[model samples]
Target: MTLRPLLDPQLIYLEPAVRAYARGREILARFPQARQVEIDSHWRNPELYRAAAAAEDWLKLKRDVLVLGVKKGMTLRPNGRSADFIAPSSSNGCAMACSYCYVPRRKGYANPVSVFVNVDDIVRSLERHAARLGPKTEPNTVDPAAWVYDLGENGDLSVDATISRNVEDLVAAFRAIPNAKASFATKWVNRDLLAYEPQGRTRVRFSLMPAEMAKVVDIRTSPMAERIAAVNDFVAAGYEVHVNFSPVIVHEGWEAEWRRLFQEIDDVLTPAAKAQLKCEVIMLTHNEALHDVNLAWHPKGEDELWRPDLQERKVSEGGMVNLRYKVAWKRRWLDQLLGWMAQTMPYCTVRYAF
Candidate 1:
């Protein structure tokens, strides 16, 4: 499939001041030529849309940021499981334009790739946040004095080799904070990570798919076998590795395909590796703006009827659509998979997004 340019909604530039000795200052200096061009309003640009469709040399240079914070004047959730902060930190702000990607529809940016030169600042921000959380004195609970940070929620860390190097920097900073841990998730097969020694505070999670399904759905990404091999390498290096079998598309012969995939994992992964593994099966959900866009991408009858409750709405003046599967259907598959894992590897902890 041909790639398309993204329709950006807004364009903003951020240049934060830094102290001379601050590690973030060095990172910020690397991006002396960097810029943040928000695509939150790009759907209104007809000319940009046309250009995105026709240009092969079109390179978008901008950083995308999504920020979410706890609601004010409210206590933490009664269940105490919800995160206080959730955001996406893009090492490379643009994507590789996979057909299954929902980024273009949601953000309206046409360019699918842009590498960030200033990831040091991003790592410093994470360290600063974690430091505020205090040092860990007890297990299974954040020390009243430790800060907890989650990295790479916005985009893949390995999108660029230089950006992936920041993972080590992040690990170093977090190690200073006695109770802090950082999480990074990626689909890229980063061999460099296997070669470098991590500080043991960073948790690496690989978003994976079966080989056949990856061929069909994961364009511009490493093949499944290579990714699995990388996973094995990371496991051997003593890193805490988690596997996310996310957005489990329910296509024809899905059950058999998943069974084969699990079998491969069971056969190759070491017992200690399996014991350290955390598996999560995610159900797809999109904002309202993505519904019609996705429907246009895939006609109603062309794809499986995965979700019936999908709806259409305009995010701005530009029309867009979002889709979601029924919650009950998602839970059913999650339960079944967890049950299978329980039988196959009872020591592993399997999780699901409901």
Candidate 2:
């Protein structure tokens, strides 16, 4: 068996001068055969460029293609509950084949890591944005000392770190700014990242699910044991290690599954990690399109995830259809999980549960 890099992009594309940059060169060195592609714009009129890649190769393209270009739009939007502000995107798409991931919805059949090479612009955006907020005058669950910026909303930096210095440079950028902390969630464990001292200016939230459910859906991501075990190590290093009980999947024997999962955390978590442990609980919200997509690539997972009777349809502002547990089922389910959490992991504080 071949040991693949945490992020193994079979083909890499850099936009002219973007390949000459330090971080760009770092990424190129890791994948020697990565070829460069030329496009007049990073975000527009690139259909001809994309048409070169075959539709049958979508999943392979998702896990394999890497685009390095400028992030021209530097606007930061308000992301209140998750973070003080949504930091300008560092990258888009992920390599992991998590069947339940929402990223594939927007990308249709093809989804791949698009690494932004204009890192200095991204850092500058964060610096300017953080400066405008000044001090966080009020209290919020996101962070008490520093305004939190969600850095990896669309991609996994843990996997991204293996391919480029984009994640590292962003973490370093956040570390220098006193008024904000860089926050991102990951399903993979990159222990090499511990070397970067966040200086209490970054938060690494490990997204989790029971091992049984994850094995069915998480695809090539790090093992649940690896993620749980890394918490103590990350805390021992300068990073604030947090847990994300995210995209919570409810199915047969869910209670027993969750109980065992929480108990495992309770058993292995070091005291230092426990003391600072804060969590954000997000319930699973599935979508019809994503369910259909999963059916094609990972049908086994869809058997557990696509439960029509338990879910209710929701229409987002973008006119996309999403499904969450019906209100009645959700109320009962949340109460049940909360009880289990309290009983199994008393030391952890749930900053927010939704």
Winning candidate number (TM-score): 2
For each candidate, what is the lDDT? 0.51, 0.81
Q: Where does candidate 2 have its weakest 10-residue lDDT segment? A: 44-53
Candidate 2 regions exceeding 4 Å error are 43-59
Q: Over the stretch 172-216, how does candidate 1's per-residue lDDT look in tens digits?
A: 665665666556667877677665555556667787766776765
Candidate 2: Cα lDDT at 299: 84
Q: State the weakest 10-residue window (summed lDDT) of model 1.
A: 66-75
Question: What's the lDDT of the predicted structure labeled candidate 1?
Answer: 0.51
